[model samples]
Target: MRNSPLHGLRVVEIGTMLAAPFATHILSQLGAEVIKVEPPAGDPTRSLVRGGPSGTFIAYSHGKKSACIDLSTPGGRAALHKLLAQSHALVHNLAPKAARKLGVGREECAALNPELVYCHIRGYAAGPQQDDLASNPVAEAATGVMEGNRINGRPSRLGPSYHDQFAGAYAVIGMLAALLQAKTGAADRHVEVGLYETGLHVAARDLVGVQLKTQLLGRAEREPHGEFAMPGYGAYLTADERWLYLLMLTDGHWLKFCQALDLPQAADPGLARLKDRKKAREQVEELVGRAIGALPFDAAVARLKAAGVGCTEVLPLERVLEAPQAQSPGKLREVAFRGLQFQVPEFPRHPDADDAPATLPPAALGQHTREVLEQAGLSAAECAALLDSGAVRAVDPAGFAWAPVRATS
Candidate 1:
């Protein structure tokens, strides 16, 4: 196997849902041994969709180990402390107050492992609104993303869980930086990433533009802005009712686009300049709409490609998976769990190489309790006792298939 950038590093993740786990997912990809510590009931995301628990769980937790402990129990806290003491880092998304109640707060964990790079992902930073509990939608709503999405009039949520995922990415970057600092002799660092803050940053360009009132030359909106009124820059519905997104950024591409649609007048006299193009947006849009509506989806796509116009069918999720771009070597990976097959997208190539594995199936709740406890230097008897006493529990009493080293005889 190729060497991973995070090889030999150990991370214990106590975060449920997205933010912290997503950050650790990046670390796990980079070859870090990330042990996800979950409650006996497991991370709620494990049962997110209607499907049985396994699929959803496996999707988020691929390439990681699981350990289930009842943090409410003293024995459970002892076992967790043991794991924390031996870990290089801990990433958690628990609320500060909740974490303090659970005894895994930064102060508590850092005292156990001073060298640990501890990252706390929160929904909001300490502020007037610090006490507000925010989920993805709340964060989006607070950050103006929801408003941006509804710019056309009707308010709606963005398709994906952007706030959670972006916060996770931010947390990952912070974790890596903190790890580097620790290597260079810095003390353990406590990094906090707020999902609301991430949402705010994700809307940075728009926010900045609105704040600064910086519009594009001769236009009322900002540059790189989407053109709802322009014919070439927005989605066009085909005869089959599928949408096609056309992007003709340059004059050359615009000419080709006009040629492809057999509407040479689209780039003619009155439409020659960009200002004129904007002025005639409604007419241009109607013309383009009629042209696209006249052609079958594939035929239109072929015509655009042949004419050197950048185009792509607005694909459904299933179609996207089957697209040639998705099937390229090293682009996607197939993973199986209990005879169930699923696919996960591979990481983009980095100058150093892909940091993490292509796929890490999610874990069963408390699947690695016995194994993890044993790795933390608990004796078999002690592990069994803890389980029997309800200090820890494994979803599968048989424990996970992975090995947890036993202490030397």
Candidate 2:
């Protein structure tokens, strides 16, 4: 973390929920000093996750400072303005009108600090439905992700905030690029990311293929390729009902697959070409399926891999954490926060890094209010007045600094 690219930089974040917060979380990991500005009532998520310090809140918010400022009040707005002037970047996930009201909109932030990289995250990009409110589920539904993820003819929303996470990543990318450009010349400091648009980008290939092929070429939509779209490329069940997926991309691969599985019937010259094998896809797939079904899962996986075949076990989602792949050395490390310890995965492999990068504990509401206002150069008297006037939320001494749960409990 001390050697990260964004080291020594400070970012001011104002928003609720996922998109905006997630962006700053990434920035924080990249070594930026992120100060999250929240309402006096605190981020809605503080009470959201089983009455929070919920897993979601702690995961995204740890390793940052919190200043519970009430944007509705004069003092709180003043505090944010001061912070913006002293920070390198400002981020918010509010609608345009809401941002304007809170004085954190693009124009407002740019006016405060022309060099500031201001990032605005929202539901949609410039569109007929630009002002429409959206969240993770809404973005998925609007971009056909839910429909694309259909099961038994029912469109299902993803379990995670996949689109929101992508939007957050995009925001970070835009902000970093803007900062880089600023170093060279006059640059557009305002960066924007929209959730619905991000969802479309994630499915760029499908969007282009599905729309262009059908609309311009007058071709029907292709049959759903269950896994890999080819006969030799899909999932098969083993004798113990464990699933494994295979990928045979070429005629050579088909030959290899045949030899690996020891299938004398499939070694004929008539089935050498992928096109020919695809024509007999049912027969080809069935042959491989029976061969695999004759052995236990561990044996089948080992045998296929030893033959240089591309394959992997279809581990159930619930058992993913138990998989050896996810537990490899340096993949995850134990971090304590919100009275619980979790094995969080690390990102950005750095050659110089000898240990997993360190992250601070999640801050309680206004945990750093007094500390940050002072750092922003506000006098003690001024901070006291704001706290007294309800411009800032009170803090809990015990919860402000997170501690791990005791083992005895």
TM-score of each: 0.88, 0.89
Error of 1 at 300 (Å): 1.7
Candidate with top TM-score is 2
Q: Model 2, 103-139: lDDT tens per residue?
A: 8878788898898998989998788988878899988
Among the numbered candidates, top lDDT falls to 2
| Residue 355 CA displacement from its true place in model 2, Å | 8.7
lDDT assessment of candidate 2: 0.81
lDDT of 1 by residue, 26-114 (tens): 78877888999988767887655443444435656788888988888999999999999988889898877788888898889889989
Which pairs of residues clash in candidate 2, taking residues 3 or more apart in a chain or in different chains?
A: none
Task: Looking at model 2, report the run of 10 residues with the lowest lDDT sum.
Answer: 397-406
Error of 1 at 321 (Å): 0.8
